[model samples]
Target: MTSLTLAGIRKRFGKVDVIRGVDLRVADGEFVVFVGPSGCGKSTLLRMIAGLEDISEGELRIGDRIVNEVQPAKRGVAMVFQSYALYPHLTVRDNMGFGLKVRGVPPHERRQRVEAAAATLKLDALLQRFPRELSGGQRQRVAIGRAIVGEPDVFLFDEPLSNLDAELRVHMRSEIASLHKRLGNTMIYVTHDQIEAMTLADKIVVLRDGQVEQVGTPRQLYERPGNLFVAQFIGSPKMNILPIEAVAGKLPGQPKTASLVGVRPEDLELTEPGSGFVDARILISEYTGASSLLHVQLPSGQVFLVAHDGEAPPADTSVGLAVEPGRLHFFADSGRRAD
Candidate 1:
């Protein structure tokens, strides 16, 4: 296992600055995830660590060695891509062993290692099946098995389940989480899916544009985001953003401007029209399998979502939304978090 450190890492393409001075330290055997919207440079930063992309500035160290100039193959990192990247004609056994074969390992040793990885990934029964013959989850398992066979210091996954169907993606996510537990190796995953990030990561780095917005554990990022971007980005149904003037009380810090309040859907409690923080008209109610989501419009014409029970609030129902102060997030006009 290895720890990864990236300091002031920056990358650009001609006029477009992709990654802007990202500083991060990933501990040994930690599962770190980089999560952000598309074009936020999460994947580019991962590529830089893999030696697939050059670091325009700053240093990248694997364990104690500075490896900014190391070749991709020599970096002791294996990346599993979203596309699976499996050979259509190769059986699962051959695909898993191909890397070992190319590295000039003996056939018997290669077979042993391949079988071991297959057993761990539960792909033993599908060893002779071609990629075309396997399900999406099975194919992804094959891809992971290929990476596991390399016994690399770090495993990099770039949205490996994005191509799979919804159910398969969920199954594959558990498979990956379990695989990490069994291997206990350092891993870095990149995805725009916040659910995956929240579920898989021991630590999460939230990026916006090209900068690091916040880095913390799943609970920290969820419970206490550092800025407006992070508060809004990390949650599933997205946090409710209310205008500063809508709420009456002043926050702890006296600031240059009034603060906008953010509350997660789960933090909101619907109450009688006059009992809660603000009165809003419920515009729409959507019932998801687990819970209901209410889209409400405040008196100031600002709209935000709130989590509700599957019971609809009645069409055009007016309700008061109350939130616990401990669950509240305050952001200044500049979009930075306010204490």
Candidate 2:
């Protein structure tokens, strides 16, 4: 395993800069995830680390070596791409061992490595099967196995689960997470899926428009976002942003500079009409098994979502909602977090 360092990393295409200066550190054996919307340059940055894309200006170090100019193969890194990228004609065993063969590993050693990786991924039963013969999840496992046989110091995954069905994605996610715990290899994953990032990463680097937005653990990002963008991006059903006046008298010790207040869907609880922090009319109620999501509209015409347990009140029902003062997140007009 190895640590990775990016100091002032940058990538540009003519006049358009795809990756602005970015500095990050990944300690040995850490699972770091890069998450953002499409075209935010997460994948570009990952490719730069893989040496597939040239750094416009910056230093990249894998462990202690200045690897800015090191070739991808020589960087001791293996990449599992968004696509399965498995050779259809090759059997599972052959596909996993292909890299070793190309590097001229003796046939006996290559066989040992292939068998080991297959065993690790539970692909031994399908070693002789072709890519066309396996399910999507199996193919992805083959792709990961291919990288594992390389015994890379760093493993780079570029949205490796986006191709699978929702159920399969969840299963593969567990597989990958278990793999990380068992092998303890240094891993860097890039995905636009925040839920995926939350589940797998020890640290998440949130990016936006080629710039670093926030870097924190899943709980830190969700509970104490550094900015409005991160506040809205990290959670499902998003955060409800309301002008401070909406709950002016309801909160105590609110910063005078705060222009906006953010309340997470799960934090708001429905109460008797006119009895809580604010009053609203329930516009819609969506039952999602354990919890029902209530879409309530304030008198000001703004809608907020509340994740409520128990039976959902009917639509257009008058209700009051309250969130603990500690759970409310305040932001300035500039959208930066405010105390």
Candidate 3:
């Protein structure tokens, strides 16, 4: 295993700069993920690390060696792409051994390595199957196995589970998490899916337009987001934001005139008709399997969401809502959290 570091990494195409001055340190054997919207320069950063794209300006180090100009193969990094990239004509065994073969490893050693990886990935039963004969999940396992056989110091996954169905995606996610735990190699995953990042990453690096937005653990980002963008982006069903005047008179302690206040759906509770801050007319009630989401319209003509019990009040019913003081997040005029 090895640690990877990027200092002032930048990339540009003519006049448009895609990645601007990013500095990150990935500790040895840590599972880190990069997450952002499309065209946010995440893939570009990954490519730069893989040596597939040249660094416009910066330094990259792997295991104490400055590898800015080193070739991709000598960097001891293996990348698993979104498409699986398995050879159509090659069987699983052959595909796993292909890299070693090209590198001129002895035949007996290549066979041993492939067999070991196949056993680890549970692909031993499908060794003779070609790509066309395998399911999507199986094909992805093969791709991972190919990288495993290389015994790379760092493993890079570029949205490797994006091609699978929902059920298979969940299954592959568990498999990948297990693989990381078992191998304990340095892993860097890039994905736009927030759930994947939350579940897989020991640390998440959130990026936007080539800039680092925030870097934190899943709980930290979910509970104490630094800005409006991160607060809205990191949670499921999103946090409900309302103008400060809507609840300004209801909350305890002076709020120093914040521009906006964020309340998560789970943070608001449904109470008796005369109980708390405001009376809301239920605009809509959606019943998910485990919880019912209530869309409540406040007196100021603003709508907010609240999560209620699975068996919640009917639509158009009048309800009272109360929020815990500690649960409210305050943002200033600049959209950053007020310290």
Candidate with top TM-score is: 2
Whole-model Cα lDDT per candidate? 0.90, 0.95, 0.91
Model 3 / residue 53 / CA error / Å: 1.2
Alpha carbon deviation, residue 228, candidate 2 (Å):
0.1
How many clashes (backbone N, Cα, C below 3 Å) per candidate?
0, 0, 0
Please write out the lDDT profile of model 1 over residues 172-262, one tens digit for every residue.
8998999999999999999999999999999999988989999999999988888888988888888888776666753333344646878
Can you write out model 2's per-residue Cα lDDT over 1-339, one digit (the tens) per residue?
999999999998998999999999999999999999999999999999999999999999999999999999999999999999989999999999999999999999999999998999999999999999999999999999999999999999999999999999999999999999999999999999999999999999999999999999999999999999999999998999999997778887689999999999999988898888889999999999999999999989999999999999999899998888899899999999997
Measured on C-alpha atoms, candidate 1 has an lDDT of 0.90
- Scanning candidate 2 in windows of ten residues, the lowest lDDT window is 245-254
| Regions of model 2 farther than 4 Å from truth | none
Instruction: State the lDDT at 2 in candidate 2.
Output: 98
